[model samples]
Target: MTDIKSYMEEKLLQFEPYMLDRVQLLQAPDSLKEAMAYSLQAGGKRIRPMLLFAALETYGQDAEKGFDAACALEMIHTYSLIHDDLPAMDDDDLRRGKPTNHKVFGEAVAILAGDALLTYAFEMVASSKLYSAEQAVKLISMLAKAAGPSGMVGGQVADMEGEQKALSIEELEYIHHHKTGRLLAFSVMAGAFIGGADEQDTKRLETYARHIGLAFQIRDDILDIEGTEAEIGKPVGSDESNEKSTYPSLLTLEGAKLKLEQELDSAHEALASLNRPAPLLKAFADLIAKRNS
Candidate 1:
């Protein structure tokens, strides 16, 4: 099996240039394009796109075939980050080791850049010549649901509402499942569609994605408490400072760590249910469990 680190790094090299070139061609105002490009190029783990490509690799499909959807997924993720950093939201001033979009581009231009990225994401998928009508439809609809009111947006609202309030474990799960998990889930499901997964196959993979998604969030919460600003690319204890409920706050630090392990274990079990080798997908679960940034 290829080393997951090596595999991920190699894909990152290929994908960054590809996605940036597409952004460079957008015929928009200079300030808008610059804002968009700045956030897109800012350092990130690129976990969503990597998850999509991993799903494709699991099915023995060429990873390149998923690039359009991958880029679309990343764009949506970037847009969310931009909006989340606004004065009205998380009010963060830093992201991925750089100034937040609103801090760099001014609030108006930053908001517009976020809007552009969100809208352009759909165009990236819908205009793809590679997918069949059915595939394109499924991809677009999954992405829409994952990122829309029933998914990420809904979670964001719930998260905002839950701030400074003690939430039950179930309520917390709902917030994370939709906010982070849904889009992460879409990454895997979209790849499954591209690889022609059957209903059963999709179910198993979706299970894996959802578990890893939770695991990913738990780790982020832990990092907020334990990680240095240099490693996490933001100030530590931001969640605590905001009076937001997080895994570590609800479950003790040890409990959150245990929860993270449980989620990763479940993700592996779901992959095992596939009844075939899926080294890359399995490795991704490991990545989510262990990633410090």
Candidate 2:
């Protein structure tokens, strides 16, 4: 094993500083900047950026080359989290063991902060010196589609709509596929372009992305039930309280666990199909499958 945990920490150390630098460098209002920086500072696993870095390094490309795209992706993800924590949404008070953005910054400022980050993400990609103009455009288009109404936004709508109803496995997959999977798949594909992947290799990695994306959500559901508040960074069992259908709700806990195994298997098989080694990506799948927080 490559001690992927240590490698991940090393990449994260490089990533977090660059992410903060970009947010700090923005010409936006001090209040808005503070709110945005606060959430980015409240860290999670940074899995999206890690996935991009893994894809890049798999192709022998430098991870630093994907920093702009990675930061942009993380910004969009953080923006979504801020919005998702609002009173009208998930209504969360705690995030990453700190007060949620809306709780600390007030709802209006938090909203603006999210809007600023979202818009700034596209600008970052467009203006990055690391990528060629063509590469920037492709990353932008992919991100816009991934984050916009037809993707993450649309999935949010589906998730909310399905909250009160019984969702089939297919329907639940649809919600997660867009809400979570779209951005995740983009994380890998963005790295593919930055790393100069051929069409066939790109498709294989995408298959890998797709499988792991669902597995990530399934693990989230499992963790919601089994993980402690200290480990989860928030109250556990919110899904049950919210009356949302989860993998465990739709399938029994054991069934959900089995499905998780299936997804991981498929994900690993996709990596095995790759033309080159994808050790980091494989480690990523294992991490998602077994993560506590």
**Per-prediction TM-score to the true structure, in the order listed:** 0.98, 0.98
- Per-residue accuracy of model 2 over 1-293 as CA lDDT, tens digit each: 35888988899889899989998888878998999899988977899999999999999998999999999999999999999999999898898889999999999999999999999999999999998899899899999999999999999999999988999999999999999999999999999889999999999988989999999999999999999999989889988998899999999999999999999999999999888888999999998888999
Tens-digit per-residue lDDT, 1-293, candidate 1: 35988998999889999899878998888888899999998987888999999898878898899999999999999999999999999888888789899998899999999999999999998998879888888899999999999999999999999989999989999999999999999999998889888789899999999999999999999999989888998889888888888899899999999999999999999998895688989988998888788
lDDT of 1 at 254: 100
**Candidate with best TM-score:** 2
Residue-level lDDT for 208 in candidate 2:
89
Rate residue 251 of model 2 by lDDT: 96
TM for candidate 2 is 0.98
Give each model's clash number: 0, 0
In candidate 1, clashing pairs total 0
Give the alpha-carbon lDDT of every model: 0.91, 0.93
How much lDDT does candidate 1 score?
Answer: 0.91
Off by over 4 Å in 2: none
